[model samples]
Target: MNQPSPKRRGRFITLEGGEGAGKSTQVEGLKRFLEDQGIALVTTREPGGTPVAEAIRGLLLSRDHPAMHPDTELLLMFAARAEHLRTLILPALEAGRWVLCDRFTDATYAYQGGGRGVDPARIAALEVWVQGPVRPDLTLLLDMDVKTGLARARGRSEADRFEQEAVEFFERVREAYLERARSEPARYRIIDASRSVEAVAGDLQQAVSSLMGTGQGT
Candidate 1:
């Protein structure tokens, strides 16, 4: 019998930020940029991507419900994440398609732990339990002041559950994300998102160039 060919694992890149930090906009531009390079990739978002996960996202974001407990919110996040990983993200990577995510575990630590005042240790425990060794190879942190980001978000449309949070809550969340980037320098690139869209896109291209290396497989 012939031996099977070894797999080509794809790179996992994530974009993380506070509300209205233009993550979705940037992710769109970044996705297009990477695809223009001829790299096969899947662009998805956390708490979503699969049917089950999308339902969970609805629950998490819906304002129709009474205020959900932090513990419940945390578990739901990982639950959706588990589904997204197994059914979508992981398989794409195993098939040599790079994964570009809007948010990942870092958002958990930021929103649930830092914003909700839950213990980081608890979130870490869930992170280990749910994800094991899986993590983003590169995480781009879009840094902006919480108030400005929230203003931008509000201007767009109605606030969701997470978006309904107060300025102080988001302040803590921003601090949490920044702190994570500080601790994991190699895996993270912080971009100032307060700049104009074109400028921000320029930095995004520059930052991702590190992973681009000489060509796609790099």
Candidate 2:
């Protein structure tokens, strides 16, 4: 009989946060850092990563859909996520390439469950149905006060559908993120994102280095 092939698993790192938490900047820096370490990787974003998913993302973010139901929004997000995982994330991981995603299902829980008052159990059911055994190995929650983050986000560009939400909505989202991190302390690193850019970058580098040293990204 032929011998079984060795299993190769790649790390999945997700960055989660409310708007203006500087996730985009840190993602670029982390990508460069991983490349320097000779790690094969793919960088992508949630609600996207594939053409179909990107289309869904456009729909999700468009400000014209003010009447879109909360459940509709949640379902659309999972629809996009399912495509992204099946088409991109799972394949890359099976090929032994670290996958760095801008956001993931956690965002759904935060934005939909917390911000929109959807039931956590509903989100959990969808998560299990959609992702199965796939989950992020590390999640960096870039945390900051909602007001400050929203201000920064607005300064950068016009608000999107989610961004245009009231401050209280984002507060709930932030709390949900923090609650998750608190519950899964080992899998999450809550980075204080209110600091300067350089400071945030340093913390991210340290977190990446620690994960690298443990062969987590291999």
Candidate 3:
């Protein structure tokens, strides 16, 4: 008899939030936790992961390019995402390695569609064109007050292009994130980022445990 083939696909998890939601820290913690559970995983960030995508990230975040058109920004984002998914995310999943991405296309909807006033229909089209059937199995939305999040973000580092936007811009971004979460509660977990780090980690742990229990057979 032929030996059974090992699982060739793995879960895709994405972390999303406005500035200063502490996604990086949570990502690290989650990595260790998932490893402890004996899961093969890859950790990466959007507009990053691959060299070509990282170059696009630099262009997208550069404060010097304040005059860049919204459409240009949106297109650069998708270009980088296309590279990220094709080069890094997809291959890992095919090898049965769970992918924990810092941000994904949802950020495009929140940032470009809500913050920059791009049409959601246009973004949806790009998402389908670039990603095809691939989508995050889980998205952790670190929700927080725009003012508090911005203050934390500014204190940590100089504002990037998106970070430099006014409070109103971030508010819209937050709203967009929440709206998406509400619309897809099954796939999204809205974490209240206003809590202490320990508390937030507890929530994350619970969410991860629940996902593992579900055993989606990825």
lDDT for each residue of candidate 3 in 102-174, tens digit (9 for 90 to 100): 9999999999999999999999998878877678888999999999999999999998988888999999999
Any residue pairs clashing in model 3, and if so which? none
* Candidate 2, 115-185: lDDT as tens digits: 99999999998887887756788898999999999999999999898888899999999999999999999
Error at 76, model 1, angstroms = 0.2
Local distance difference test values of all predictions, in order:
0.87, 0.87, 0.88
* RMSD, every candidate, angstroms: 4.0, 3.7, 4.5
Worst 10 residues of 3 by lDDT: 1-10
TM-score leaderboard ranking: 3, 2, 1
- Which is superior by TM-score, 1 or 2? 2
* lDDT tens per residue, model 1, 35-151: 998878899998798999999999999998758999999999999998898888878888889999999999999999899999999999888777776778789999999899999
Worst 10 residues of 2 by lDDT: 1-10
Which model, 1 or 3, shows the larger TM-score? 3
Candidates in order, TM-scores: namely 0.93, 0.94, 0.94
